[model samples]
Target: MFTSRAKIAQRLLRRLHGTNATPLAKRPARPSVTMGRALALGLGGAAGLLGSAMAVASLESDDAVFTNWSATHSCHPAKVYHPESLKELIDIVATHHAQQKKLRVMGSGVSPNGLGFSDDSILTMSAFDRILHVDAAKSQVTVESGVVVGDLLSHLRTHGLTLQNVASIREQSIAGVTQAGCHGTGAAIPPMEEQIVSMEILTPSQGLLTLDDPSDHRFQLAKCGLGGLGVVTKLTLQCVPMHKLLETTTLYTLSELKKVHASLLVENQHLRYMWLPYTDKIVVVTCKPYTDGSPIGSRISDDIEFRLEELRALYKQVATVPDPDHVNWRFTQLRDSLYALDPLNARYIARVNETEVSFWEKSQGSRVALSDDVIGFDCGGQQLVSEVAFPSANGSDLTFMEDLLARIERDQIPAHTPIEQRWTASSRAAMSPASSPLQEQVFSWVGIIYYLHEASPSLDAIKDAFVDYSKLFEDVMAPYGAAEHWAKLEFAPRSALERHVLKDRLRSRFPLEAYRTLRNEWDPHHILSNDFVDELCSTDL
Candidate 1:
């Protein structure tokens, strides 16, 4: 039924967009048979046998080295299983545990890390995607773990309901995003995992476990389990009535932002700022609920597209230039050209201004659209990213961020991508960077991205430069009690984690002991363990 409905939706979307391009929904093929027997059969008699058969039928011998969306990490798994039902998932886990084989769960593989990789077997939740129930009165929906955020938002739009917040990219699976501690910009909104009211998990030791009560200690542990606890089968999420949002973007100097940062946070429902590398210019985006019947604005305007194309062309030209001196000259010219385009660039003389101003002008605008449409920004091509979260010294000070920026400039790091800053409320999830036992009202998340343009001949050089720059980044952030985002480019080993300056701070902030206890009890045999999980959990701190 979902397949046919999805096909019809694809056709309609194609007609609406006036394009013959194949829809994203049509990219992945589904299997013929679903998992398990009806609930009437229960868990015994023919039901158990049927479930096992289904699991076996769904299993495929996959020996390919799976690469993540960013093409950053790859791992070869022995086999892959696509279980469509709770019973089948339980059976698969049991079989894998009995065979003493390790297992990992993957959903769309949007994370840049190697979290979903396993040498033994991988269980993909894509087949289990479905919306089981919706309670309009409570403004809640129950969906399988594999449901993508974009699809979920679209489904909820028809019912006049939507998630309270979503990350910049909507392609990640709900379970994937939740477990990885994905968050968006807003002082009131916590990570996506906070929206999950309850979830059903299939564990090797425990056949099927339902965590419904938010008061339960285990619920907090399981919310951001890093895929170390078990496989999440389904989740019940709290939602709000659908609404439109007004988005405004403008260019601000770093000095100017420092003064109004507090007011900006208070005035907007969602706020985020981007700092261009090698420059002091920042692009500030503020979004708030819009109630007036203003016409919806286009997500991307022609002017914005034109600027982006020009930037791309400039980068392409730099890649082809053979002379190092000429390349450096082009870089300066490109920077100057970008600064010239900014309306605010005229305030500072070209020679006196050392702040980067490119791309800020293109993104500046005011648009009123559905909250989801306005919030979801493009992920921008294959890239590597590192996002770190640190506690706000005060609710409104930008001293720490200012110091960090100065250090980057002093060190002369070759960072070209924008540094994004956003705020989030404290979370209850044990492993979340934003988690706080004190229930802190605000925390700052800073993200640094590096685009790995595949077509560029200087890709190798860029990667090398990023590696050296990242070491300095880690060193500078270490003293601020910063924690790396679970799904980003954090390759620190167990030894390094123990030695980290903020190790004790993180241990205290996150309920590390309690989480370890619960994880051990649920996954005694470590069937879902991977190198990353093991290293992370092995930290003595």
Candidate 2:
């Protein structure tokens, strides 16, 4: 589903002006506070009077920063709760369920959308960080949902085990990453959720339940439940033996990418590429299982260091412009100048090569290290990002990618950031972007990013530019059945879902009917629902 660029621009302006522009009819009304507060007071007072062992801090302040890492979306919950134990978490959920108060579960608040935003209450799972068990023999780890990816990796490494894959950013909690279907680049590897052997979910009705059977249909629904069905407390993930990896970075032209695209996916254990907009050059990175005999050396480069300084200076000059309109114009000029640089320039190409080369070199190159250090890379500072996944069932043609690049060039979309292209095997999770129950082997993910550096003119200007380019991207890729990444930024509205083609695509691509049924059966009162989830799960489409 898509919206017109003009409407998207108008919406961005309204948001920038600090106004609630969402239509009243479309916005879900916040739950009644009188009933919620009364129930909360009753349950809480009873527990305090009884001197119950369960302990949790309840906050009423509405100024909490429940925003994502990018700081693009923020929400103010009527109450925020941090439960340190399973009993405490259950008590909180039961109280809210009785009070008819909606709840949204959050973990490090990594989602770029409003998926975790709620007016009734917000439950932070960070307190649940505990490694329950480590089965070194089976190569599996059982941990609480709050365990951060980095921490889990370190613990697992001590026991000679590691996760199968991780997102680009390893700060996200394990539950958060799995729920959002976070994935790495590899044709043979699936998203993080696929590694789950079992999980303990606390549903509003079922209370605390464990799904240990892989054959159970509910496992597929709950694995990527979008925090709808329940709160994930603990998960048992099937990990692999810890091993080191060797990574290499190389630059290639557009023509070269087309020729080697097929081989690249199969040749390396992990492969990803970044295409520079308005240029024919791209950077390809390959990570494979490291063994003896590989070369070990590191070369320092200052190309990126120099470019960062120049960018900082340019941003400073643009920010000094007095008029807002002039600031916008200057920002446009900055983007154009950044994108128009010739790839032939020794310094420019050197900078691109160094950036990629140094990333691996600093992390794992020149020496074998854990996969977490090798596969994961910094996503950069705060930025606005929109990533979409399209099925490359055939894995041969690059028409969709070629058309996207062509459209950006023809329209001169002011896209200065590199377009990242990655591949992943099909996922069994119904809501996964790369979901293909029919046994499709490969899928492609294309990410569009607009970095909101400190020197940027304004958040509004960056958002406007991003929306403009995204609308064009959506229009061109819609024919190929593209699906937005759940954790990334997307502007699709409910009205757009009414399109027959998009509606059919979504229905077929995702098990929406089954998910709807499971959600209704488990969360009949909609306590775990939010505006984003509601719109996305709407049956009207």
Which candidate has the highest lDDT of all? 1
Q: Which ten residues in a row have the lowest lDDT in candidate 1?
A: 40-49
Per-residue alpha-carbon lDDT of candidate 2 for residues 357-469, written as tens digits (9 for 90 to 100): 33323332233566889898756656678888877766432677678878876776655446788888888887888877756568888887766655544556667767777
Q: What is the C-alpha lDDT of each candidate?
A: 0.67, 0.66
- In candidate 1, what are the lDDT values of residues 1-541, reduced to their tens digit? 1222243233223322222332222224342322221111110010111111343533333323455666766665566676655676778888888886888887656677756666667777765667888899999999888776777888899899999999876756788889989999887788899999999988788768899887788888899998989899989999999998989888888778878888898889899887765566888989989989765454435464454544545444534443344233333344433322321222322222333355456656788889999887755656667788887656432665676677766776545446788888889887888888767657889887666655444556656666666667677777677788888745552256434644565565577777777778888878887877775566754
Clashing pairs in 2: none
Residues forming the 10-long window of minimal summed lDDT in candidate 2: 41-50
Give every collision pair in model 1. 279-356, 280-355
Q: List candidate 1 segments past 4 Å from native.
A: 1-54, 57-63, 294-358, 393-397, 458-461, 492-508, 539-541
Question: Model 2 off-target regions past 4 Å?
Answer: 1-54, 296-368, 395-397, 489-505
Strongest candidate by TM-score: 1
Global fold similarity of model 1 (TM-score): 0.81
Model 1 Cα RMSD, Å? 8.6
TM-score to true structure, per model: 0.81, 0.79
